[model samples]
Target: MGSEKIRRWESGALAHAATDPFGPGPVPWLRGSELHFDDTGHVVPWYVSPAAPPGPRPATSPATTPRPTAGGPRSADDVHRQIKGFASTGAVTPGEAIDFHITVDPPQRFGVDIYRIGHYGGDGAGRITTSPRLSGIVQPAPLTADRTVSCHHWWLSWRLRVPSYWNIGAYVAVLTTDDGHRSHIPFTVRDDHPADLLLLLPDITWQAYNLYPEDGRTGASLHHAWDENGRLLGEADAATTVSFDRPYAGPGLPLHVGHAYDFIRWAERYGYDLAYADARDLHAGRIDPTRYRGLVFPGHDEYWSTSMRRAVDVAREQGTSLVFLSANTMYWQVELAPSPSGVPNRLLTCRKRRGPGRSALWREADRPEQEVLGIQYAGRVPEARPLVVRNADHWLWEATGAHEGDELEGLVAGEADRYFPRAALPEHQGRILLSHSPYRDAQGAVRYQETSLYRAHSGALVFAAGTFAWSPALDRPGHVDPRVQRATANLLDRICKRD
Candidate 1:
């Protein structure tokens, strides 16, 4: 129900939003009422970019691929450009090669920052979401003018590794420019699951589509990727460099990194051996992803590639379990390219005008492919705080009870029935593990201004944490909240029990 009742409250809430043009929005009393609009008009102004952080950006060069330079001699609104190939998800030729190009620019002023490359399992979680490896020679750091043509355009390549154990996931090359700007390129990752896995294929990477950045020059470092052997692979403890990270030097991808870290941590705590492998590994040897009982995803997961999507579909058909513990999971459109070293993959965020061609990252239709994880996005409501938890006592929440004042200030709670139906689960798979419970109003009216999940679909399981801010609320140390502990334990218990 992406309807207006919520919008009504939203318009009022914005006045106090951090981005508000005026002073703090009306106090809590005026919210959800005409008093919010009292003598003045709306208390908030239109949105504006947040304060820019101090950091370097990846440089681009037009020497390799076809494109204009970054931030140089361009149209007013066209400083960046999107990667050219998107439909290439299922088009890999086993060991075929491909090339990808992208560009980036500093937000403003007369300088440029040094940049790096990211190596992604690509398909493991779909979309492009990790800072895995780097490619090419000459890590050039050109200024704004020179970069538009020589530095901003990212030229990378890849080789598709169609491994025997391929499961739902993609291979990727992440292009990061000077000063921490990023984009994703995806290669399809293949795996063998039950022939019926196609049914669950759509969800393969749903739990962790991509690893989105939390903004600020500092990329999200809360994650690590592992391999099937229980061997530690990608990022590691204290978030040290990966085995190949420094050589690559790309900034970070989106939510995939953080999610991987979160998932691995949870897996270790709950007893699952998580490992990671690239297309090259699959190409050289055979793999068996089903050896593990479940595949995991963690924080801020957002992108998903077609290959990863297909592989996971097969895994589900084979009855493999998936545990998607993140939001905005599996959404980006990624691609892969051929390189002397390996294929380069990237996330598709050409939307940030400060980099590449200043393009947009608006991807529609993640719904059909992303439903496997039990969630899909309608669009981002920037810096929007969602009211979480309605049915506090649903089976998923049996271990805990709700408490007052556990949430951020000014958060709006919605009626149980009014969450985003457009993003709901099909009801045929699993069941609604938990919900953002809603209650009657002072006069006993229901308000559906919160977030909730419904479960359906077969083989795949469903577990929803109605509230959107889990890390700050529950996952961190000293951040104890009864509901979070109970819910966290419940999720692990269910996974173990089912396994």
Candidate 2:
């Protein structure tokens, strides 16, 4: 009944949305009447727009990949002039060789250069590796676009091994041609070194929400609310499975932009001893949480595999601290399968149908996310709202001098999480409920967004900010709240010492 109403409501919205005032692009508010319009009358959804305008961008060394601007690639003409390519995998361990599939228009010879993202020089230092290992120019294979997916992955042009000296962090490879054209392919280099903190990149969530359709034909994503042509899709009409062989349509890919980079810039600037891994690392048992004192989830991490959830549960029991700095985490239950060529964790499967089958919602699967997160996804807050502090006496708020009922400006924008009833919880004192902000849900019902924290019997500490915008508030010039920064630092400092 709920699905039927949503479908019918969406149909009526589409009829009216066809005449969007902005024009024929993606109807930003096609999901419902909820939308945020900017000064120019353009739809600027909170999820896409950052709460704070970022500070000066890091400097790109002449030897490394050129960074993409806030505004995406200039035009089709501009893309052709710049070399574009993708790595075989999203991440690679140190000393492991990865293949690069390159496409150079007019079929030219291109070279590859690599750089690790860090604050080596300072806050604005983008690519820290001043001298990167450069590869010789090799002629690329003839350009041939994939028939099923309209992407030019011409051929495997170069295979490069990451040196042992390369630091573990986000790395970008610059593909440069003789004509001075340059494009970047970003990937993470995982580190096995024992560290106090483990930052898990939500690459799985990044790929699940990627709707990079081929030639504008079929839309692909785990989300079931909308179809490819900007029309509302019924519960069973959405794509159940999506492949990882396609390039991300969004600017500089999905996770590399707003949420993940915000945390990266702030964490690196503070000189935290951090290690990196993809979300799949948790599922594959590659991440032994016992080795690290804390695990950090930075962005919109929505999907979770059963194995990954169990791993985190055990980590908490074993006294490894955990922090979720974003909202809508562990809300969807997805399965990982091998690609056509047998690459593990290459395909994400999420059949969102209700009852007796593969249901995407963990709530319906008899495994509520609140069992671990302490809060479940409530809904999205279309417009920005201030995060009202409720537990100012908590240690997380130390040194910030925040008082109860004080509101942090626009820190609760985008999707939010709320404490929900659950069957099981570790025996402890009443959880420290943090922020409580009121917002209207999709049904136009008034609800309060909640951020929470607690400690298990094993002495493991867990913290959830309950909003997707928390990371962005850490370092953005205008959006940076001293309270938010101080709170995060307090937690990090305490977690490391607790180890």
Where does the lowest 10-residue lDDT sum fall in candidate 1? 24-33
Q: All models: lDDT? A: 0.32, 0.64
lDDT of 2 by residue, 309-405 (tens): 9999889888898899988899889899886678787777776664466567888878888888788888888677889998798888878989999
Best by lDDT: 2
- Which segments of candidate 1 are over 4 A away from where they belong? 1-263, 266-273, 276-289, 340-363, 366-370, 378-387, 403-430, 437-457, 464-468, 471-474, 477-480
Clashes of 1: 127
**lDDT of candidate 1 over 382-410, digit per residue (tens):** 33343455456665566576533234322
